[model samples]
Target: MSHDALFQLGMDLEAHPAPRAERAAGPRSTTQTEDTIVAPVPARDADDRLDHFIEKQGIRCAGAHLIIDLYEAERLDDLPYIEETLKTCVEEAGATLLHIHLHPFEPTGVSGVAVLAESHISVHTWPEAGYAAFDVFMCGDAKPEKCVDVLERAFRPSRTAVSELLRGREVA
Candidate 1:
């Protein structure tokens, strides 16, 4: 999408009505003056505005980055397997894969990156620790969360934690 469209979306989202509570409260504190009167504080609706903005934007929303931490993983030592799994994950997520690079450690472990049109997915594994860390970042219509299922299936981790962050959120 063009920057102008994005800017318009932000503007549309910002045009929310002020809360009734704030409007009813009016001025909480005022200074008494003979010739000068203090101005009332403006209603603070930053949190409400942000919530409304995100809601209105919907799927046309900002990019998403999924940070995954896996423990007791089964295939941290297999570089080739990891490379293929990541490719499949990217495909399943409806993202276009541009390129992929995989690296193997001296004796064990693997690291790989799969570049995509929307963004990228990267993995760093520690075979000795049975752990792996993955970053899946995608913008536009791509669904980064879909990759989590692929990761869980391929790695067979005993425990997993995932965090989803909205990247490049515009609030102007």
Candidate 2:
């Protein structure tokens, strides 16, 4: 569930989820003095914060996003197996999982997402083609690279293709 949804249900997940903050169009705080107005300064410090962006390879970014493609994969239509794999990925990546939601398409195929405190892991599968696509994105100290190995073991993909992108790469 989303942060607001969690609150509505009387559960507080976190003080501020970084993923939503980066993309939210919410109310802004401003201070008006006798002559001019002072714009709000965002909270960027890491004090008392559990998850935040980090510097990787001399480039500062919010997180790493990995595009993993599995070919000749097995059990692309099994929802339970897929869910377990996602959970395992989250655990292996050292990311905190918040919620999991999956959908099974008609005929054959399963798509799912595992929401994490660091970020998220999503999957799209094609059983007929023996293929699956997975996206593992996380920030802070979480290691998204670990998911590739876990996925290979779970799906038993004969061949895999992987690509990486640094999310929220700020301009210098």
- Per-candidate TM-scores read 0.64, 0.72
lDDT by residue for model 2 (1-172), tens: 5655654654434444536664376522221122221223244556633357789888898889999999999999999899888888988998887777777889999977787778889999999999999999999899999999999999999999999999889745
State model 1's lDDT. Answer: 0.72
**Residue lDDT tens for model 1, 3-113:** 335445433312343356644655232222222212233344655321122321374344778999999989898877987898788779877777776777888888767
User: Best by TM-score, which number?
Assistant: 2
Candidate 1 matches the true fold with a TM-score of 0.64
**lDDT of every predicted structure (CA atoms):** 0.72, 0.81
TM-score of 2: 0.72
Clashes of 1: 0
lDDT of 2: 0.81
